[model samples]
Target: MPLSTRQSVIIALIVASAYFMENLDATVIATALPHMAATFGVTPVGLSIGMTAYLLAIAVFIPISGWVADRFGQRSVFGGAIVVFTGASVLCGLSNGLVEFTVARILQGVGGAMMVPVGRLAVLRSTEKHHLMRSIAYITWPGLAAPVVGPALGGFISTYFSWRWIFLLNVPIGLLGLALTATFIPNYRASTHRPFDVSGFVLSGVALICLMYGMELVGQLHSDWRITVAALTCGAGAAALAIRHLGRAAHPLIDLSPWRIPTFRVTLDGGSLYVVSVSVSPFLLPLLFQLGFGLNSFAAGLLVLAYAAGNLGMKSVTTPILKRFGYRNVMIVNGLLTAATIAMCSLISPSTPRVLITLVLLIGGLCRSMQFTGINTLAFADVPPARMSSASTFFSMVQQMTIGLGIAFGAIALHAAVLVHGNHAQLSLADFRVAFLLVAVLVLISVLYFIGIEPDAGREVSGHTRTASR
Candidate 1:
């Protein structure tokens, strides 16, 4: 039976709730690391191992999520993942030592890896083609808001309350999600069963593990040069092998058929780059306000709220705008406008008016939210029903990888700028200028990919038609 519009929107919101919990958990921990380290009797840097354990678990497990969901059924797998994640949160809050905390985090990562992709798969399965724009918009907001909101929320919680509350808070949310999942989500499974591809899983796992770890290393200022190079080199080599094996395998772990569609290909190629570029702003903006403008952390955080507001502000109009402009036009025009705003950040200084800075960030945030919705929605617009699982899985993998790399890219750009200016002692406004410019150029480069798309691409989902050029 086809789902009603109301039913599809409800399911999308349910998945969005899950996505919010996952994204918030990933970032909220960052601010509480010092407090967590104090409880564990270790330095802040030492406690980073707990995060590493979590990320590695995610890297190793995500490639196989589709297969697991197919074998066990989406509801069973997704609901079980929530149970595991919620249970792990409780264990994390009660941990007495670093080892126990690390173990709990790994469990959380496993649950997160399965929860995200499978939950999204469930949404895709339930939603009709024409309603995809609204469905994707519902799910995209959490990702835009979480990065801006997490640190401030974590700091507030840690200041007045216990750092443990961060994890414990998820208990109520997870339970709610579980109940909703059980009630609304269907037990969807593939019609035909395919054997698990163990070899493909191992190869892809190694590739993602190395790739993610390498990006992590590069983001750290004091990481060893040789290890970073080796990790990246090994990741590239493993990725090549994994691609080769997946191409020839009888039942590949992740189906690569979606890449054949132009709309899907644009998301994987251009959309990934766009994500990487936009992600740099959040990483760089706080530094720019604090380091360049001499503002306190709280003040800088307040400024970022404007950006978040812009993100949320766009949600109401995203569907109508896409319906009005279509994907290709929206991406090309909005993408350039977004890049221009990013570059405009480079021009900001102490003398720049506060209102002006906020306005720029607000505009940038609005453009970013629109671009993300368009790219993500267009990805599956042309994907067939049979290939939906593979397409969603593949999209999730690329999204994770690009988000991780975005932070690393920002760090590298800032470091390079510092070196050029010969300011090893302290960073200056000049450094941020160069970094913002580089990131803007990256966003602009992604525009070319959008240009390759047909003007009427994704018209079915957007409900927009291009008139003949008379």
Candidate 2:
């Protein structure tokens, strides 16, 4: 039987809660990493493996999420995912060694890999076309909160309580979500005619894993040349294999034809560059605070709160700005603004006032929000309804991959700065200044991708409003 309106609302809330928790887990470890390292007796690089393991697991399993959701029902996959994720979180907290924690993180990643895409798919399939965007907007609000709230929350728990509490917090929320899903979420099965596309799946997974691993290795540039060369070769070869598989498959996992769309291509190019540049800050800022400026975890967490404030503050106005100026203009101008704000971070120093640093981060966060809003909206604006599912999957995959790469690149930049300045033990105020400047330059270069977009291109603001109203 079809669900009632009340049931649907409950289901949406359940999924949103799960979604928020899943994403929150991804970054909650950042502020707690120092403590986790101390507890595990590992170096920064070794502790970073916790993040790497999670990301690699997610990337490897993402391609199969859609298939699993189709083979089983959405409710089954989503509910089961919540249980697995929650259980894994408990194990992660209980872990006594680095290897054990890494294994638990991978298991958590496996559950997360299923939770998001399937939940989104359920919401999409359940809602009417007119109500679709609104439903998605509601579901996505929790996700926006994750980045804003995660650092502060994680820091408070890790500092006041224990790092274990960070993972333990997921338990109650997951249980509630699971109960809601079991009660309200409907089962959805795949069409019999749709083939699994095994070859495409394998090749695509290999390609993504290699590329992400290669990017991670790039951070260890001082490592053995043989290791670097091997990773690069594997990444390149896997990419070639995926491309070949895409050409031959009857039903390719990702339809590369979308790249042929000029607007789609431009949006992706601009978005990727923008994410790579902006995504690095979250990972870099905490380390800088502790090592460079000698701030405590609580204080550093507050600075991150400022970034979230700017992001949330801009949410209301960002869409309107895109509508008024159109995607091309908004992206081009805002992209520059984002880069300039990040570059301004270079001015940060131990001698710099806290108020000034916070103000700079606030501006950067606002611009980052605008840039992401514009790019994401424009990327999908031209996609036909028939291709929406594939487009969404592809977009999500790229977003995740880029975020991982961004952090890796930031690590590389910081490591290089430390090497150049001959400061090995602790990062200095000067090291952060140089690293921020380098990332800011990279952000500036991203503006070139948006240059391809015409001012008149993309749906107009009035049109979107009219459609929404109807």
Candidate 3:
């Protein structure tokens, strides 16, 4: 039976609500970090544990979401995730100590890990191919709004109300999401059953955890040789184990064979690096404004609002650019633009006009939006529907892991510069300028990955006709 328009809208709203909560939870903590640190009697580095715990939990559980959805049913899984996430938010708000907060965040991450991809999958399963783009556009709107609103909302609540309010706000939103999901989302189960790959799952989880932890540790240790060596060793060993396990397994949790496809491989590599570049800015920008520029929490939050505004404004232009230039051209050019904007951020100084800084952030946000849309769309453009599940899981995992690593890297860089300058107590504005420049250079290196893309790789995405003779 054909569904009514209202039913479709309701389903989309349910999914978007879940996505908004997930994205908001990811960034809302940024503005609250200092307050969280003071309350827990920890340093900036210590507060990172909160972010790390959530990220690590998401990384570990992402692969299992698909399996669970297939086993139980999408509607059940989706509804249950909302419950877990909302309950965890309550726990997070109620926690007093760092350990308790971290634990609650882990639970939140588990729920979050399930929420997004599963919700998206639900939308896709319900919508026809012709309407897929519109459905995706609708789902993406909340995600765009989350980052824009997260900083200001977090700052306002943490400053006047308390950091706990940030988490508490999710209660009402989650409840609404739950009700919608139960009412609108259809139950879905896989027809062809594949045995659960227990061994593969364990190895992949171990590998991801080790890699993320190592990258995070590298950021924390900076120039500390011993710590860097230890982290690298563990990370390398875990990666090797995962590779070997996947090669032999009948049904690996994550099939690395996708990497053999040149297009998929190039896209994933570039996407991972692109994510790393974009992810670091949000984490570092708040600290730069509040600590270095001497802005109050609310003012710093407002600056972040500029970045989000740019992101929102750029979305309308993204598809047209991709259509005109094609994916390879779009990615290559936008990647360079993103790198240039990031480099421009390094030029910020205490005496720099607020208008100039805002412009830089705005341009950076626009370029980043283009970069993200291009990368995400191109990553799956060539993927056949049968492999969509694995591809989705792989893409989601890389994106989340890179985001965590990027933030960790930014923090480490800032801390190292401060330590080297022998000014830990007073991190000067100049120090932050140097850190932004360093990250910009790192972002520049990511452009090379986009350069390797095949010119013809994304033709279908741009609506160009393929010549049968070719």
Which number leads on lDDT?
1
Query: Could you list the CA RMSD of all candidates, in the order they appear?
Result: 1.4, 3.9, 3.7
Quote the positional error of residue 329 for candidate 3 in Å. 1.8
- Model 3 per-residue lDDT at 426: 72
The Cα local distance difference test for each model comes to 0.89, 0.76, 0.76
Q: Tell me each candidate's TM-score.
A: 0.98, 0.85, 0.87
Tell me how many clashing residue pairs each candidate has. Answer: 0, 0, 0
Determine which window of 10 residues in candidate 1 has minimal summed lDDT. Answer: 461-470
lDDT of 3 by residue, 429-453 (tens): 7677777777877777778888888
The TM-score leader among the candidates is: 1
Q: Specify the poorest-scoring 10-residue window by lDDT in model 2.
A: 461-470
Task: Tell me the spans in candidate 2 whose CA falls farther than 4 Å from its real position.
Answer: 1-16, 33-47, 97-99, 123-152, 182-189, 220-225, 415-427, 454-470
Decreasing lDDT order of the candidates: 1, 3, 2
Error of 1 at 169 (Å): 0.8
